[model samples]
Target: MLAEQTIAPDHPVFAGHFPAHPVVPGALLLDWACHSLGAGQSAASREARFPRSCGPGSRLVLRAEPGKEPPSSARRFAITTEDAGTEVAVVTGTLGPLSTAAGT
Candidate 1:
């Protein structure tokens, strides 16, 4: 995976997501990570432990298990195959079990 693009904040998706807070939603961040890997072929799965809310300007961070598979989402995430390989973007943030996903 491209390490640089993984954490770059210039991504357009975050622009209108939350103007006031400017926080990178937990699901979004995780989805991006999944995208970095091959979406359909990705063996990644995420389980965020939302001990505390990630407020605005929280500086989104990408944490991965190296070669672990990406997580599954209820909503449809964007998964595409490029020259480089398959990429999974825009994971399902519509789920209401964030706290449970995070094991909070």
Candidate 2:
């Protein structure tokens, strides 16, 4: 699954999450990834890696693919800046469940 994410410039998360140098919280980023790639269903389990920081008002793309491991429930995914075309991922992990995600 794939998703286009545009973090709102005025998103409420900016209020307390580093008022001077705000960045999206890791937990919130995970939630966004889960909701977008999960196809609405929550994940049974997940493992993730955050290679970089993502700020508000950025255009991002979330991508997910089935993991190579057994059981077929495993998945691999990444979030990247839509325009950067860089070698880094703002966030990447074993997320994007098969159903609804949390905080929905």
Candidate 3:
């Protein structure tokens, strides 16, 4: 399954995150990812990774797949974007219960 988001170039977070050279906070990315993925329980286990920097106007593409090997209720996801013609992973982790319809 796939979900995507684009950070606004004028997003307010840029102001405090770094006035000179703004970079989207990893927390914000995680929040957006959880919401986009329809996470059912906020208390459930979750994690975020910063493999690369995300700036304003950057497009975040989320790809989700069923848990590997076991087919459990848990789902694996990754937020990535195009970098130098190659896809770069910005955040990767497992999500909690899904609140909405399942992903394909």
Candidate 4:
């Protein structure tokens, strides 16, 4: 399951973040990514790099990369789980200029 939301200029987070154009907070992005990854659903260790901020209605593609040896190479899966049903992820992360799904 993947999750994504665009931060509209009138969103609450933007209200406090800035009165003018709003920028998505890094923490929020991280949380969104984490949740999308379902790290808690499976109770697996997870990691995410929110390198970019998404604006209102921005499209985010969150993919779950499950396997061993980790995603190596420049373009690879940053997140990985040791077991399919262990509920314990071995590694997880993100890579890219804006942390897009195509980053790695």
Lowest summed lDDT across 10 adjacent residues in model 2 is found at: 95-104
Global CA lDDT computed for model 3 = 0.73
Taking all chains together, the TM-score of candidate 4 against the true structure is 0.46
Which digits, one per residue and each the tens of the lDDT, describe model 4 over residues 1-104? 24434445566787776557565665665555555654432222233553344454444444454444334311223322223343232223643222233433
- Which stretches in model 1 have alpha-carbon errors above 4 Å? 6-10, 39-46, 50-63, 66-104
TM-score of each: 0.35, 0.77, 0.77, 0.46
lDDT of each: 0.39, 0.71, 0.73, 0.43
TM-score of 1: 0.35
Candidate order by TM-score, decreasing, is 2, 3, 4, 1
Models sorted by lDDT, best on top? 3, 2, 4, 1
Instruction: Give me the displacement of residue 69 in model 3, in angstroms.
Output: 7.6
TM-score for model 3? 0.77
Better of 2 and 3 by lDDT: 3
- lDDT score, residue 73, model 3? 52
Q: Comparing 1 and 3 by TM-score, which wins?
A: 3
Tell me the deviation in Å of residue 99 in model 3. 15
lDDT of 1 by residue, 1-104 (tens): 23223334555656786666554566665556555544432323433334334333233333233322233332222221222243323222222134434544
User: lDDT per residue, candidate 2, 65-88, as tens digits?
Assistant: 877875465678888874455545
lDDT of 3 by residue, 1-104 (tens): 47787899999999999989999898787777667766634423344567889899898898887655433656677889888888998878776554322332
